[model samples]
Target: MRRILAIGGGGFTTEKEPSLVDAYIHRLIDKPRPRICFVATPSGDNRAQIDKFYEAYGSLDCEVSNLPFFNGWGPNVIPYTDFKPHLLSQDAIFVGGGHLRSALAVWREWGLDVAMKEAWNRGVLLAGMSAGAMCWFETALGGPFEQGNYGVQRGLGLLPGACAAHYHNAHVSERRVNLLAEMHRGLIPSTLAIDDFAAVLFEDQQLVKTVSWASTSTAYRVRQQNGCVEEAPLTAVPLQESLIV
Candidate 1:
């Protein structure tokens, strides 16, 4: 089945980070020691984020490598990263978060967008947090990057409808409002939202599971009826604290 896991950001990328939810993401891969590739094309291949990805995954048994899209490192400003061969070889692709607009542009230009859909068809798990997670959906909340606020925009469409990450963060109230308002206004279809420390897993375009690191986090299915946008909570299975380490 084609699988996509949308994360709410902050899970297993640093020594001090929590891995409970991340562990769930890793286990989805059906390999003894999965070949996991990190794609930080979204974050402009930021060095620190790339370093953290290696550092965190390095502790695990999986073989890890990163696909960096650096200027001059490729044929043009978009980079010449050969998107398929390396992607087809991996068991999973973990993308990093950054400016979604620019990230999508670069990926489409490099053919990484098409390659990613191909990888998904071949049973490779496509997953990421925030902007990374947002990339796989047809529409997502959090963009335009103006005035330090959020808005909705088109996504890669690997998954249907819309999604918003960090749903419960107090700082993102405007984001939540914008998403619900957009839905209520009939600007987008039904949407999904996940708080930090949680993830909504989709298999074959169907939501198969919702899991959270701690009992406190959750996911939601939001839809518009008439002129109102409402939320129906999706209970997340709580992970044992032991799995966090």
Candidate 2:
């Protein structure tokens, strides 16, 4: 089945120590030594972020590699001509977070978008945090645009509706408010709002469950109702206890 784990926040890049969430992602692959590839396009293939991935996964039982889109960093990047086959061979592809709009543009230009779609269809576990999470849905909240305005942004539409990441983060608390407003205004359809350290899992385009590594982390389903915004929490299971693969 096609699967996706869309994380709102918190991952190897955000934490110094490895998290249960990362381990949970590894378990989902069902391979004794899963071949997991990091897609760091959103972070412009930031070397620091890539290093964090290695730090977290290198000692694990799985095999780890990364596909870099940006050039000049010079880190054993797979050639552009080999991207399709290389991505398809992996058991999972984890995208890193960064500038969403710019990432999608570069992805489209490189035709990485098409390769990802194929990977998803082939049942490769597609997962990521923040921008990586939002890219799989139909629409996502794009923000701080021109005078700090937030609005709807297009996605690859692998799944329906919209997505909002960091919904409860104090640093970007406005995300929750703006997301509700957009849904209330009918500017975007029902959306999934995910907090830091929380993630919503999708199987074959249907949300199967929510899970989190942090106690306060959670997910929400928000939509317009009776001319007002309404939201309901999506119950999350603790990833430390169960392997929901």
lDDT by residue for model 2 (1-245), tens: 99999999998989777788888888888679888888888888898988888778776776878888784243446676678998898899999899888888988988998999999999899999999999999997756533235657789999998898998998876677766665666766888989998999999999998998889889998888889888889999998776644
Q: What TM-score fits each model?
A: 0.88, 0.94
Candidate 1 positional error at 61, Å: 1.4
lDDT of 1 by residue, 1-245 (tens): 78988887767643276476556666677558788888887778787777676666666677777777773232112224465887888888898777888888888887888999999999899999888888899987766533334466789998988888888877766667676666666776788888887888899999988888756788888898767788999978776632454
Poorest 10 consecutive residues of model 2 by lDDT? 142-151
User: lDDT, candidate 2, residue 176?
Assistant: 77
Highest lDDT model number:
2
After superposition, which runs of candidate 1 have C-alpha atoms over 4 Å from their true positions? 13-15, 71-80, 145-150, 241-245
